[model samples]
Target: MSEIPPFEIIRASRRSISIQISKTYGLVVRAPFSVPEDIIHAFVDRKSDWIMKHLARHTEQRERKNNTLYYLGHIYPFEYNLLQKETVTHSGGMFTFSGKVKDSGMEQAALTRWYRKQAQIYLSERVYHFSWKHELKHRKIRITSAVTRWGSCNGHNDLNFPWRLLMAPKEIIDYVVVHELSHTVHKNHSKYFWNLVESIIPDWKAHRRYLKEEGWRYALPKF
Candidate 1:
């Protein structure tokens, strides 16, 4: 016998349904356009276990996100290759890679510096292109090695992107840049915000999925 569930339900004008049970925030339900309230409540009750598991996982993730980067001997990728390598550059900005180091502090510093520079170059150029195209005036874009967030937008419209984004493909990077810019118009991830995103980048769903699933592959290790 299931007692009448007491949970706040949110119905969106989209084609998906979800139930969120936050530890501190409590239970919240989201349903597709015009879903009946009774049906939504039934759905939440049907998947109570799953909702609890996800909420637990989300709590764990939030806790982990609060930690800081150690930046020890963790390996970081330069290009698409997963394996860490000894990277070097020629006269031009052209880069080359070999393999990882054993215990050379000098080599590690050199590689880290190179990665930071590369991140700056790649992120700035891409941010500039999208910012201009969307007419989303922003203060400045800089790449930092933040522990958690991929990117952020400040009150002044200053956009900050994680340097790790450079490790992914250009399309993924574009999605991040566009995501921050979209925030300038709508600060939250409301339906209108998503609509604004789809208007600019029609294939945004694929990119969003890629970032959520595979984007972590591009993240540098503790180093």
Candidate 2:
């Protein structure tokens, strides 16, 4: 039998035991401080397969992030300059950051800020465009840092979209925008809601597939 991989345990004041694997920490098992060591070990044993799968995924994502220099649906080389003031510039298929980028964390932070700014401008514009084209009215639009979902619509008619969507192609971004705007009329994913989306974007299914299959490539490392 193969040896089980070792994992870190974090005992805290919590209700239940849970596991998390990320680039920063390979495998972390969190449990209530009162839980017995043997019970924790048993829980870990039961979840070992899931932990290994996520650990492998984390490793692969880290490797891919290391190889990627450009992001946001654009293939541009990222340039860094330590002598100049701390600012980011994009021009001529290049993104240049002039400032003290002390480490990978700082670099990721700078990129995240830039992505948010771009999302504010680009996503807002797209949302407005779609709303006007479809004669749809929405209370407001907000940018978010959600990891799992691309976009969401609340009962208040407020739409929230992840800044990461800027990393996808424009078509995919449009589909997400339309999907949320449709919620202003129909809150659920009923057949009428899908038909409404198809009316505006006939090929939304292809765009959705692209996001599902290729969106991970654009994921930035979590700081």
> lDDT winner among the candidates?
2
Clashes of each: 2, 0
Error of 1 at 5 (Å): 41
Q: Model 2 segments beyond 4 Å from truth?
A: 1-72, 221-223
Kindly list the per-residue Cα lDDT of model 2 for residues 30-139, writing each as its tens digit: 99999998999888888777666666676766665533443557656566778546776787777776776546767777777888898889989998999998998998
> What C-alpha lDDT values do all the predictions have?
0.66, 0.80
When summed lDDT is taken over every stretch of 10 residues in candidate 2, the lowest stretch is 63-72
Record all residue pairs in model 2 with backbone atoms less than 3 Å apart, i.e. clashing.
none
Let me know the TM-score candidate 2 reaches against the reference structure.
0.70
lDDT of 1 by residue, 53-168 (tens): 56655554454341222111122223222247555442233333334544345444555666678777877787788878888878877777774777898888888887667666
